[model samples]
Target: MSRSPLEKFRTIFKRSSSNSSRSNSTQSENNSLTMGGENYDYDEPPLTPLELHGYKSTTKHRLLNKELAEELRQHVPALLQISHDWELLYSIEQSGTSLQTLYDKCQPQIGESVNRRRGYLIVVQDTRKNIFGAYINEHLRPLDKKIYYGNGDCFLWKLEKGDVKDLNNKHQSIEKKEVSLNLKVFPFTSVNDFVIYSNNQFISVGSGDGKFGLWIDSNLSIGASDSVDTFGNEPLSDRKKFYILGLEIWKIC
Candidate 1:
């Protein structure tokens, strides 16, 4: 049967509309599967670093919680009879403080004592309020040189926070779920610049940039001769930027 041109156009439009509807349905189903459920909406925002790193509950707080701090302290052993009572060395409420400034403040604490090795701990709170820290087994000295190395015991750990009640009753009041330690010295420089601790002392920590590297006595000193310490071929600026919430230098007194 010969149909009018207008009728043919109407038929084509109907077929196109049906195909479009089927395509949209298929896409919606695919999206639902990707999102983990049909009820999940794609319009919802993505998970932030804090949420992803298990800091969902305390992300809003600028200061680190006591429970979490205690948990982090557990990882640092009191080597050579050093007390667990950590003393502060330096801090910056905001960014833009030079590494040299921190070193100057730390110098007096480190002292000229060759008899007792000093251990240092640096805790930084990022903009997201996620707390991370590192430990240096030896006291950092003001150096005329731009680099120093550390022994192999240096490592970094990320504090994993979770609901204490979820674990066994033994962990009832503890919010720290786990401490993920990376023993491998982070490859920061071409030769892995770090402080070498003698007398059986060692420490390590994750940098502000989330990389593992030991604290070095390079350009950090007030009168460091070099313009910048060579961390491999990378610029000093490539190094991690941290807002020092707290710095502690503990001597084996």
Candidate 2:
């Protein structure tokens, strides 16, 4: 019950990104192996440095505001966050809501010649407004056989409501106050290598016995969260099961 915001994320470094939604149908049946499949030119102005800290790009994210992004940034491993900018790979609002679209948009960008690979951030916000998700070492690929696919970098995290209070300012200002945005990151406990699992049926992160740290159906409309040995995370959502309100995936580029 004492998990810090983003879990003790306030004590760590800081910055951004969540999501869920009901889709009319799957966007594409054929999976594309390419990353940034098409031009994602945005017409909106770039977010201020207040949001992203150092990384700069014109792409405006749907779920990631400056506060959330900065809060989550503190929890990421230094190797991943040091000089990298988060690039949008898949978004339920910008891209289609289909789970397959997530796989396609997040296709691995590294090649055999490259020694380093980008990290994946999967952020999900449920209907109840709980923002939580996982970081993956590899791109998502739905397998035909039942098996887990990511490495040790995979972990679960969440954004929590910091103490909110009324602000007493000059001229008796009462509208704005300092709000705390905390983050909690649950790293791999090494309980099992089951860091990530994906198949045509669904995609999941963290596992122990039969419970999963986070579970999202292939439809991407609903999801569930539970404490698991892999992450030792608290139930990410208030309820055992929740409807996906928004989903977004960002890659450390």
How many residue pairs clash per model? 10, 27
Please provide, for model 2 over 154-209, each residue's C-alpha lDDT reduced to its tens digit, 9 standing for 90 to 100.
Answer: 78987663221111112222223446656789998887888888887788999778
Candidate 1 lDDT over residue span 99-154, tens digit each:
55555555644446566655555544333222344555655544444344554444
RMSD of each: 20.1, 18.7
Scored by CA lDDT, what does every candidate get? 0.36, 0.67
Query: What does the lDDT come to for candidate 1?
Result: 0.36
* Local lDDT at 3 for model 2: 89
Among residues 3 or more apart in sequence or in different chains, the pairs in candidate 1 whose N, CA or C atoms overlap within 3 Å are 149-194, 149-195, 149-196, 150-194, 150-195, 150-196, 151-196, 154-203, 155-204, 190-232
